[model samples]
Target: MTIGVNCGHTLHGAGSGAEGLFREAEHTRLVGQALVDLLKEAGIYVADCTIDKADTCQEYLAKVVSFANREDLDWFISIHFNASASHKGKGVEIYTYKGKQYPQAKAICEEMAKLGFENRGVKEGSGLYVIRKTRAKAMLVEVCFCDNQQDVDTYYKIGAARAVSQIIFNSICGQCRQGENEKSPGRVQEKSKEQTTFMEFVGAIARKDWKERRIMLPSVVTAQAIKESAWGTSELACKANALFGIKENGWKGRIYIKEAIEQKPDGSYYKVDDTRWRAYDNWEQSILDHNNYIATRSTDGGRSLRYGAVIGCCDPELVCWYLQRCGYATSITYAESLMKDYVVKYDLTVYDKP
Candidate 1:
């Protein structure tokens, strides 16, 4: 089956997202990406219909629909998180275009409710832009409320991204692992169960950093620390308590010496030993310094913030997006790696508390 999946909203700005305890735009991307990964693993043809850039909501809706329409899709799914001004919502809901019926839609609600979220059931979404405009059968999933702490807590409890993706996968794949593609890696590779200890340990530090400094989301900091340092096992991280690979262009504090890999303009990589990296007194200091870099570093001789868009941002996806845009990392998939491989897989956004 061919499906078009859209991660709702832009990274930030015009069609950004709803902001409450967490970010709507970001979590949608997390869920959508996970779902896409699952469907593809089952040997299903998939089209990512997400449009991350738009000048207005109309543009966002139109672009996404146009992209999906271009594909000969049998199904189109738009993933989103719920939000209420009163912060009273704590449920899972799905919407189908008026007069349309999808058995999978009801199935997804029932399956998700098994994870402790109230089953809000299926509803009509006639006026929804994506639903009305898309050529294929469409459903919009509001996984849970972003503004409600109880809902967010429940979402993290069951691994929102994976649970939602798996439920959707079961609805479509139905005991069929992969259709005629046995060699395709179909099973979702879960994280090491042993990583829980390290996550809770470093999570406390990142949570403290967010609670005290209000600088960056705890999930982003914690994910960076985990991915970059191999859960605090890297020699540089152990010896100096540093996690970020931020170079030492102008440093006055202690430095950690290590071999650094650099990518040349011609897309070639070379290793250079004796490279200096900023070191800290502890992991807390390491996180603090990283946040300091995001807040303080500038290119116009300190006249303006180089990564001003990321300051105080709660959306890990948008934060990473802005950081990558501002030349924070060399990989073109920097935001993708941080979101899919770290934040969503580990359910780290639970740390993005109020």
Candidate 2:
């Protein structure tokens, strides 16, 4: 059966997020991309309805709904991360439009809980923009909280992105003996078992130096590194060890020049001249620079007073919002996008505490 997979929110524009330990947009993209790949591999006709840009939240939601409706797909799934002001909220929740629970939604949530997340159960999402507007059977999956450490650990430990993808694939394809479906159940169980050691190793390394610094939240630092450096895959990150994209404002060290996007006076973005970004000797150095960058910005000229509002803030959503207000980035929804798309979805905040 054909289905429309929407990664929920714009990849780079307005109405893009709700942040926590990681940005919602990034996590949704990662999971949505993986879901699409898995579905395609299983020979299901899939339409990727992710929006690259839109002027407003309404426009963005409309565009996604329109795309799915226009395709006349059998089902639509919007992937998202859940967030709460408390930062203690945890688990997986699925929302279908007002009345009844769709079997698919229930099934997806049940399968997701198999990955060790709390099953928050299916609920009626009456006023939700996307849930109410879509023509086909649509469900929004709030995978887990970005701010909860235990949830974050579980997300990585179970490989939620791939696991969710496999669940969707199995739900749609049923018990058919196709190549993609063969031994799927066993494989998912195997992946869950194998991911533990790797998850702990990665978490320990990411948390080590950040814990020593005791400056910004380690989850926030790691989230920014993942977003800015494309998880160490960007040219600046790999070649120069510049994980946080620190610019050469007054740096005396080596610099790397690259074309970068700049927002203009009229809110339009343009490619400016090759910008000089700070180059570090190693990944740890880059992390140290990131810490110093925020610390200096907060303390320089009484700026620390303003930064103090969010310093040691455990809420990823609040942390990101304050960072944006402090002019950390140009995007208006940068914080929300980060919290919703990356932090919460990927459980990046696990690094925040220990």
Candidate 3:
């Protein structure tokens, strides 16, 4: 099946803060390119549909719809960052029509969470043109909340685009096996069993021994780390050497840093110094922290479904979708960005090596 990837917007005057101005339109374009590169490496058909000069989301969506129709693509994934007036929220999220398209939507969302990302959950939308107009299964991923410094710092790594591309490659093609198309060099290859394991559930940990585990594909891990740690360039990653961007926000024994940001209790934005996460000293610490965070939420009484939906069940994309439903971040485009980048970047195959 053919797939299309697009960055949510051009880099020019894109806003930051809760307004999303941190990344220039050019940065978004670069991110888009990273996604395309990863997917192509996985032997998947990837389409390039970034028109960075567009002035508005409406115009951009229209261009994407037109391209999908003309290309006859089987799926369309739009990449984007999220913004909010309040920087209190964060995490990964996915969006779909919330109706019949929910199945594909579920798949997309789960894949993202498995790739790492605070599960935001899948949401239903009638206003999103890409999902409404495209003939193929369309989903959008909001990698993280740009407004939230923690989210932004965690997800906006310099090499995040490339990392995201790897995850998307594994998610869609995780069912395929390695070397399945070796005989026909020109044909697209399928994902190997390694593409669908737990390592795929979170970003790469940089653990040498991890190779022994029958974990998911390397691309997926890379994407998750990119999304969570901004491709290993976040303050947490750089200072603490935490590659996966795990936080001990509520833990009693863990260490963390605090930062100031705008927050809203009811309506107006207010300054708040929330506890920020410190990068883990080692990959295992980060992974264990992440696991605890997810597992703890999974048992939070009546809120299990909501949390479960965010992380999703066995399906990786569903985890992303559930995060959206949980309001992990305000950005509507998180999940789309992750999937699109992962598929186009050839990152999915990186796991084949030791």
Candidate 4:
């Protein structure tokens, strides 16, 4: 198959991609180049039809279309990131020319959603210049919202450029199958077990980095991860890679908006739909950021450490006590719950050393 891939927008000046947690133009180039290489690897002819230095938006669009028209291509793809007025629009959406159906677009959207991005599905591009003007069968991909911090976090978590390229490539060329010569049911179950043990994966990552990152007491950290992330099955954990219930306040990184159940001081629970939590690229980063939050969090405008009592504590239970007393969680029995439910139940303190 011969194809033309256009990384939409310019690097700078007019027609630049959206700017939010990341630069859309830069990512477009990254993804576009990645796609070009992947298709070539699959023995398909590909052309990079990007026009990055146009004087104006109109010129940029015209040049890309003109370049694409010149190529003897079977398919044309334009990659872009969307933006919203509230800086919170999220998800992956693919577009085809008006009244046109491209199965590749549908497949790509489904593949992206598997990485935890919301699937906005394939839509008709009624007036898009790239989709409308291209001579070949055209599709434009809005690979998540640039201004949405939640989407940005997921983008990097799934390896950004490489993930996007692979999804698009696999959608068009079929996923590369490995180790699958029709596996037996027992083997399938074993693989499923391996994939489902992600909590252990997070534990291994936390243990490996706690000392180097200067985070003390992996026992408490692990317990907190278990309690907060619900053994790695919580929506926040699965979707945002957020281990702790860390809020988005004062966080410079991306944010995920999730509907969470907030506990009251009276032991009652309330539901909140717009809770903003910090998002990370992976569980390791989530653990590191949680450590930072613990070390630097303060109540009196950074004048005093909120959880200072446990800074250098050697006892795991003591650290939990300090966290509970310091208002780390809203649960009335937060410390007790972490201790009895996770730390002791799972013998987590054994991982505190080395």
Q: What TM-score would each prediction reach against the true structure? A: 0.52, 0.50, 0.45, 0.50
lDDT of 1 by residue, 192-240 (tens): 5546776787788778877887777888888777766766655577788
Error of 2 at 68 (Å): 1.2
State the lDDT of candidate 3 residue by residue for 27-54, as single tens digits: 3444555565455434355566555445
Count of clashing pairs, candidate 4: 0
Model 3 — TM-score against the truth? 0.45
- Residue pairs in collision within model 1: none
Better of 3 and 4 by lDDT: 4
The segments of candidate 3 whose C-alpha lies over 4 angstroms from its true place after superposition are 13-21, 24-27, 55-57, 99-116, 156-159, 175-354
Candidate 4 lDDT by residue in tens digits, 1-354 = 678998878888999978887888877877886676467434366665787678999999999999899978899989999999898789999888783657788888888988899999889896898888889988999999988889988998988887898889888776642113134212312223533365467667667767666555777887788667655645577789997869986999889996554557744334466789999998889988887787888879989988788676778888888888888877677787677656675667767767
Clashes of each: 0, 25, 75, 0
Cα RMSD of all models vs. native, in order, equals: 16.6, 15.1, 18.2, 15.5
In model 4, which runs have C-alpha deviations exceeding 4 angstroms?
Answer: 177-354
Error of 2 at 330 (Å): 28
